[model samples]
Target: MPSPAPWLYWALLSALFAALTAIFAKVGVKGVDSDLATLIRTVVVLLPLSAFVWLAGKWSNPTALSSKALIFLGLSGLATGASWICYFRALKLGEASKVAPVDKLSLVLIAFFAVVFLGERPAGREWLGIALISVGVIVMATKR
Candidate 1:
């Protein structure tokens, strides 16, 4: 049998970790404020990521990056921080099952944004899948 694609493996692992994040955040935010919870989670993420960068010899001087790269990366960092804060707040106020599916609505938005912003066209089948995901998110998010 042929080996599976590398992106598939990493994507699966990321999905698994994301699910765990939702569950853990839901539980962890029980009594703590969501903003504080997000801060703690950011520190926890930084420790391992910092070690990974160091151990893998991936560290580089940020000063060498171009202005566009710096600006986009900085914006991405801000968006990520905002996303985590909102996610933590949602988890604190809602059931994980509900919150997680609603969060995955980003998948649909990602496809749309990729098409518009990146000038990439997804095949019909891919659009079908994205549309289905949008419907699924609506189903999961709404009251019966």
Candidate 2:
């Protein structure tokens, strides 16, 4: 094939991985502690990510990354860990469909944070997307 169009493949793979993650996590948490389950899931994730890092030869490029970049990466990792903890706990206590939609509201929080901290100037389209996401979350929350 002609290089297998990168963006399309990546989007599809990301969706597949996200869906699989929720289902697998939901099943994995059954009869198991959520925190321990999240830890196990992280271990599973690290295997593939570690292989990709090694294959990309990023281990030798220590100096190329700035301290600011490293700091942001560490912060992002911390946020992701916190999100996973909340998500698993929510899944353990609530319906998967419900928890998933609530977790997705993080996109709204991220967009607002980007504007406040990253000085991001979102265009009209992005603003519209944020509004729609907000409405969806509200609707999901209100449904009995």
The candidate maximizing TM-score is 1
- lDDT tens digits by residue: candidate 2, 1-144: 577677999888987887778877888899889999889888988999989999988666765789999888899899889989988988888777677777779889989999999999999999999999989988886689
Compared with the true structure, the alpha-carbon lDDT of candidate 1 equals: 0.94
Lowest summed lDDT window (length 10), candidate 2: 56-65
lDDT of 2: 0.86
Off by over 4 Å in 1: none
lDDT of 2 at 142: 69
For all predicted structures, in order, the TM-scores are 0.96, 0.84
lDDT of each: 0.94, 0.86
lDDT per residue, candidate 1, 116-143, as tens digits?
A: 9999899999999999999998899885
